[model samples]
Target chain A: MPETKSQSFDESQSAPMHKALQREIQLARNIQMKLLNGEKPELPTGEVSGISIPARLIGGDYFDFYPLGDGRIRILIGDVMGKGIPAAMLMILTRGAFRSAAGAAQGPGQTLTMMNDAIYKDLRKLGSFVTIFCADWEPATGTFVYANAGHSMPIVVRSDVGTVTLPVLKGVMIGGLPGQIYKEKTSHIQRDDLVFLYTDGIVEAQNAQGEMFKLDRLSGILVEQSRQTAEAIQNAVVEKVNEFTKGLPQKDDITMVILKADGDQRGV
Target chain B: MFKYELIDEEATTVISFEGDLDIDATELMEEEIAPKLYDCSNIKIDFSKVQFVDSSGIGLLITLIHHLRERGIRVRIFHVSDEVRIVFEMLQLPDIMGADVLPEFEHS
Candidate 1:
């Protein structure tokens, strides 16, 4: 009779393996949550409110607002190419790169170009890309300068004209190619104007029948809820998406950043 | 919903993905596929069978792509459905991912 090889087993191994995995997963969740809640850099001239909802425990979406020395606010919203640990990791990289590049006094376009170059140079090392939107707001002058790197175009809600979707700032996704040039554009925000920055999660949310929440719905919501505070606007947007999904599991992270020019005529 | 299969064609590793690429599948992919990324030079992702992909899925792909690109490795995708293709095009990722649209196979 051929001797059968005994299978090795520790009765205690199963439980600890499961427990260790659970602990690791929990730790990851906590880290991601902390990154999401990281301090909102102080705005010297205006107020800023931002919210991010990961479709799950981890996500690829991110937003940030920081005050510049020249009395302008720097706002950034971006989506990494993938989700989960990979996306989360890339989000961290993009955030770091953007912050460093912006701190060097680079304008939106130049900052984006440098960021794109940095990401692209590391792309072969990281094997991913990101789409980003960076903007500078001069509270005193009510002038807004923005650059887009294949990210979603922000919606501007004017006091008199209602909701308006700005054109794409014209650029490809960061880390996709080398020497890509990002275009910067400028616009003036009148008193009481509202600027809404968001991730695709909001508009792409689906209903029971698989219908999209749609941009029109989002625009309508913005128009109706324009008077709400930044926090309220974030909450309202989440609520609308939740209602539309009707209890479906959120498929992606949802992030929104709202800035309202308080109609102050004082220029910085 | 997610399913994965490893196919060997002419020494190339083709991991075929099907169904929804969301949070659940994203985790599964990281667990099952991430380790293998370092082992192959020519990695082909078959998304023709994929139904839907959200930001999480895109994030996972980006991470994997970034890692592979760093190693001087390239990832190729094939069989993308119309919907997944649109998402890629919207994000302008085809050129970066080196994904090529293959001719649809017709059965006579």
Candidate 2:
């Protein structure tokens, strides 16, 4: 408890400044939500949707869908290290990097490489890292390619094979090293298959009994609801987690993005 | 939650930690380590009792490592448990820190 000049500043002397700080954080949250939730990218032959629920008033989980101009769409989701304000600040920094990288990179692997190169120094200097999963989808060709950076794999719910975690792509987390190269894998989706992407927050959410809603449980839920629309499946998974936690306070953010092959043609 | 004991062994300083090395507990370690570092050249961290660590904890360690390196202080880590090693290896701590912490790999 040694009083550093900033940490031990007089609280009473900065009442207005405190309020201003709170408002600024609120604005930051607003900006994050606006950017993450803006502009749904509809596939000509499929559908995609995403949502993020921060554990705190503001959180660090981020998800976005950017439609590529060439009949393909790019989706990105990530969890920054830590939570709340510090994590949120890094989340924005990651977002800027992702936006810039996605626009210029030719593939998901290249996007991660660019993003890591852009922010690795800063993140390592800050002593934190981010796990990210990025993928590109082409409805016309049924081609899906993805790359991961120490991220939890997405669930691939095949119409025939039930729900399975996406194959893990071997790559280190962003900021783990300099001059890192990321590789991607490609897969084809059937007409009724679904791909679910998420951050670790969802599976790590703990219940009052200290039991976690782990990966198996999440996969089970996806298996049961494989036929549902992207949004309905998303909400159902959220509902399941809510029931399991049963109103307990959580320490991590939860985020999910779902894509169903030929989903726009099917009604929710 | 964690506890630490600073034991001076000959010319080397050993900081043995028990319990979780986490973000919330970082300040506690910082309060102690910051003051004693200048008087020491070689530092050893004992993680035998550490049950968990998060990114912020790792970050704190990396920052401390950089600071020590800048000041010409050397650091070594030992007794890493499987739980902690998973994180250490995932972040490629061995390559980054220039340390030999993961001398042996154990799976639990």
Candidate 3:
């Protein structure tokens, strides 16, 4: 008999294989959920929270917070190419590279460079890539320094300035090239200002009519909910996307992180 | 959905694409592209009529490119419009496609 893809999933051949496959998928999902939703580190000058919702039983979107031990919080968020199993598996590979790079690298730019170097071969081998926005929130200085890897810029809600703006940062996506260096950008995070990071799935979410949620709607919600705490802002964005989607099938994984500056800045 | 045509030249193969390359079109894309993609030395993919490509569509492109390159097949992309260029830029397609991909640009 010639081998075929249908043979493994053929119901007539084996019931035990189906049960085994289901159990393994569930186990994989549990592992991914726990690793992705780890505790956010405490910050002296700001507050931060994040959430990830998978379109399938497992997703490719990823976000994590790590303390640099120097009054700064390192946060990384990204979207892996494709969805479901292939993407989820690469997400784990990316996670490992990020954690390893963040430890030895001095800044976000260097961290991305290190990560790209570590994972470029593997991503190329698998015919996939990841887009990451790596940032270090310097709470004492109220500065948000970030590096981009082909990910779209995150919205910055300036409460004191009363404006919503995107920070300037440009770089090729990770695994785009073997030895590409990413560019880092900076913004002064005023007290009460909010920095929002996310994957593309949020903005690309679609409605029943095929209209996408889009960046304009997300910006509006963030600016309107800027005064709220990090948790509230995150919830509001998710709610807005949900409302726009209206029970439409989710096309990809959604993940986001919001960092809100603490203390008072009545007169900026 | 995308409709592709495979034109066999004496030395090169041209796979021309027309239409959107969303998730729903991957299987169709695979069925069309796979047979022609094998054992070609020079491949040119024309994206002039391609409108949009989502992440899943990008996966197909990447996987195809990887396969082609492993066989040492030279690939060329031509007539990529501004909209499709954005998606290519996001995924950094030019890097894999090489620099001489008919002047595709990244939107600022």
Best by TM-score: 3
Residue A154, candidate 1: alpha-carbon lDDT: 87
TM-score of chain B of each: 0.82, 0.86, 0.82
Better of 1 and 2 by lDDT: 2
Task: State each candidate's clash count.
Answer: 20, 0, 0
Model 1 TM:
0.73
- Go through the candidates in order and give each one's C-alpha lDDT: 0.75, 0.82, 0.81
List model 1 lDDT by residue over A1-268, tens digit each.
2233222344447789899978887788788778767776555454567888876668888887767877888888988766667778888888888878888856788888888877787754665667788999987678899998877888888766898766555567787679977778998876577788888888878788878897899998888877766667778888888888987976667888888777333321
DockQ winner between candidates 1 and 3: 3
lDDT string, candidate 2, A105-218, tens digits: 999999999999999999988877888989998877789899888776788888668875555565777887789888999988777888989886788787988788988999
Docking class of 2: acceptable
Taking all chains together, the TM-score of candidate 2 against the true structure is: 0.84
- On lDDT, the stronger of 2 and 3 is 2
Which sections of candidate 2 miss by over 4 Å? A1-15, A264-268, B2-21, B33-51, B69-86, B105-108
Who wins the lDDT comparison? 2
